[model samples]
Target: MTVAGEWIEKITGPFEDKKRYREYKARTKLLPESHRTAVEALDRYLMYFGSIGKSDVLLRMVDDLIDLFERAAADGTPVRDVVGEDPVEFAEEFLANYADGMWINKERDRLRRAVERAAGEESEKEGESPR
Candidate 1:
């Protein structure tokens, strides 16, 4: 992307995320009650905690979510069957598959680099000590 485009995304991401999320919401409404409720609850958690930054990645994730729920509704699969027993684990695993633009991952990388740097400096200090 050009510098201008990056700047524009920084400015507001064109507020397009809202539009994509709205589309996801509208599509989810067509799902069966059980599927819709479970999807919506999962959607809420993902939105609040996803920490995804790129608009396109978020859109893709939302679209994939709709696709999954739609198929489940069509097959009359139980929500528990779709998500297994632990919803949080399922949600986290779902998020893990889509790693693009995840702020948490960026933070984790930053932390790893910082720790490595600190460790290197500590080793240097120890090496400089009198034998």
Candidate 2:
């Protein structure tokens, strides 16, 4: 599903409004990849907390995050510094300010494992140990 559809499903439950979802999906596709990913992550974070209904706050937070990233990129901050070599740690740290539950703990472990697996695959492609 498109990020928009995924968000809509999260907010209103499955298959709530196909037309509006499609519209949002199309609009989302127009966003830059970085912006899209940030928005998606924010959506997932809010959904995990069952706060998707708070669209206004979520939107503002996502916008602020995107702005921060954009400014950092403009200032020549390395992507690794922004997202970290371990995306799970970075994600957990970033979400810590917004999240307050056991869900984040489990999600952090899952994210870490997924990032480590991806890094391992990349290392293999480069003929190096994951280390």
Candidate 3:
């Protein structure tokens, strides 16, 4: 597995197993609130991981996460600014940051494809009738 695959797996795999998720949440709670952005993102990643339940998806996101941190650190993105704000805002900025990153274009494309696929399935189910 790639580094990205390993990262995503480490973050998401635990949560898939009942006992592991409990342990993960417990361990995560011990982390400072200042790390909330990263932690919350990790949590959400786990959620998405469960939703997709695909190892490839998790692998892609793992690479994306590393790139996001490196860029955030190099540009001096305040950790407090991300983690200390509203949850909604944090998610928006979090996704946008990844959307705008250079190293994870494939992951971004993967997300777009997923969204498009969902939309297409919904549209197909709705038939040819106009909205």
Backbone clash numbers for all candidates listed:
0, 0, 0
TM-score of each: 0.78, 0.39, 0.34
The alpha-carbon lDDT assigned to residue 76 of candidate 3 equals 71
TM-score of 1: 0.78
Give me the candidate number with maximum TM-score: 1
For candidate 3, the lDDT comes to 0.54
RMSD of 3: 11.2
Instruction: List clashing residue pairs in candidate 2.
Output: none
Q: Output the better candidate (2/3) by lDDT.
A: 2
> Residue pairs in steric clash, candidate 3?
none
The lowest-lDDT stretch of 10 consecutive residues in candidate 1 is: 122-131
Local error of candidate 1 at 45, Å?
0.8
